[model samples]
Target: MPRAILDGTVLAESPNTVVIEGNHYFPDESVNHEHLTGTATETVCYWKGTARYYSAVVSETVFRDIAWYYPDPSQEAASIKNYVAFGRPVQVEL
Candidate 1:
């Protein structure tokens, strides 16, 4: 199983996760929306398409752009669509 944590809080956990480039992409339902805030941030990957970012708020601190997901991935990377991946400042425990 994989879990996403921040500031001692478990933000998301799932047994079914997709690993791409060493990052575990948790399914949409596994993410806890309560701790997330939408950000006007996006970056494009040549093969993954557009990735949307999100900020996580925990213990009064906001970690910006620490999480992202591709809602409409390129055909080659379609398995991760709608799945979320967390980066530094946020921890993914396996």
Candidate 2:
């Protein structure tokens, strides 16, 4: 199983993941909502469509734009819709 963690707090974990561009995208249901909050941040991928972000707060420390998912992905990247991916400060334990 693979898990997304921040300061030892598990954010998301799943045996099934979609790998794109070397990033592991976990299913929406696998995420631990208590550690994340949606933000206004969004970025567009030329082929994957728009990505919405979430911030993680662990022990009162805020890590912004640490997780992202495409709520509505393009046809080419539809498999990843609703799948979350962690970046940078967030660690993915395999």
Per-prediction backbone clash count: 0, 0
Tell me how candidate 2 scores on lDDT: 0.94
lDDT of 1: 0.93
TM-score of 2: 0.97
Alpha carbon lDDT of each predicted model = 0.93, 0.94
RMSD of each: 0.6, 0.6
The alpha-carbon deviation from the true structure for residue 39 of candidate 2, after best TM-score superposition, in angstroms, is 0.5
**TM-score for each predicted model, relative to the true structure:** 0.97, 0.97
Instruction: Give lDDT tens digits, candidate 2, residues 3-83.
Output: 988888999999999899989999999999888999999999999999999999999999998999999999999999999
For model 1, name the residue pairs that clash.
Answer: none
